[model samples]
Target: MIELKREGDVFVLRMDAGENRFHPDFLAAANEALTEVERAEGPKALVTTGAGKFYSNGLDLEWLGAHQEEFVPYLESVNALYARFLELPAPTVAAVNGHAFAGGAMLALAQDFAVMRTDRGYFCLPEVDLGMSFTPGMSALIQGRLTAPVAHEAMLTGRRYAAEQAREAGIVQRTADEAGVLPAAVELAASLAGKDGGTVRAIRVGLYKHVIAALRGPALPE
Candidate 1:
């Protein structure tokens, strides 16, 4: 349930929920999308949003709630998927058009930039309520993007907040009306695409190199 389209150098990726869940099949589709994105080569940019209103309702909470036995593997797969997104060598933007909850919010944060609609929907991460914690890898990114108090509240309260609030908190980069969000994201993309391709690639790759190194580092003895 991932849709990929190319509008010049801008690749538009949309997540479509299957059976109201992240279904393994959907992750397969995302894998292919990542493959094609890499194939495009050179300096490329991505604009990722979701179908319908929600940027993503996050991982199907109801589905997760119903299948408790699957929790460990589900988190394992999702964490792997998120790590892949973070390691991509290109600039990625989250054009949040609606709600982003839990995993959905984390997925958006995986992108290089997050631009959200000022209207409906919001962002939240409620794994704490589920008796777990943010994946260790995700914790650093959250701390880097959000101020101490804001990040603490989001992780602790599990409450959703609007786009403007997210921007103010530093989680979202830009905020615009529903109709303006995508355009604003495109505006940012256009600015990046207009610059020197090699310079842009260098900046993008250099920034993520540290994250990837961390991902690939030696594992602690179990």
Candidate 2:
């Protein structure tokens, strides 16, 4: 589900080719990889990308449907991961190599920067269409990272923004061809890796203080 590789000062965390849904095992693998990244020595940054088809489709609906009782615990774990990314000691970038929907989009937004594939793939929040809604923490994460108008359109309309549209809306910092996505992300991460880890972390924590708090706080009623 997750593959970790080091390219000089940057760590590339690749999601295996698939829907890359946020299943328990997926979360565990991602968390374990993140722990390794955090504990590694020397200057480092992270670039997260998907192998094919999807950066992530979102939460594992099939699993959740069969195991409804695990919903709250599952969300708790998801939120924890988001908070971790938001305040990771080093800079992080999301290489959106393919479709990023719902929780998948949230995961990308949790990063410090995003680079998406322009020729294909979408970035969308379809919770409304799925008869669901964002939790308080989720809302905070989106609102904190995006402009108010962009957040409103994305959350309320469930629009499927292609890479160009997403970049125009400031959801993504740059766009590239499929082959260019991960490389662009890695280059960006490598360039930013020179910043002091503690300073970067402190700046992120200060900038996203409210969102981190909401992510770590209790979820509102669903």
Best candidate, TM-score-wise?
2
Per-residue lDDT of 124-143 in model 2, one digit per residue for the tens?
A: 99998989987789999999
- Note the Cα lDDT for every prediction shown: 0.73, 0.92
Q: Estimate, for each residue in 116-177, the C-alpha lDDT of model 1 and write its tens digit.
A: 98878889887788786765555655665577998899999897889888988888999988
Clashes of each: 1, 0
Every model: Cα RMSD to truth = 3.3, 1.0
Error of 1 at 193 (Å): 3.1
Model 2 backbone overlap count: 0
Error of 2 at 60 (Å): 0.8
Residue 28 CA displacement from its true place in model 1, Å: 1.5
Question: What's model 1's overall lDDT?
Answer: 0.73
What is the TM-score (0 to 1) of candidate 1? 0.83
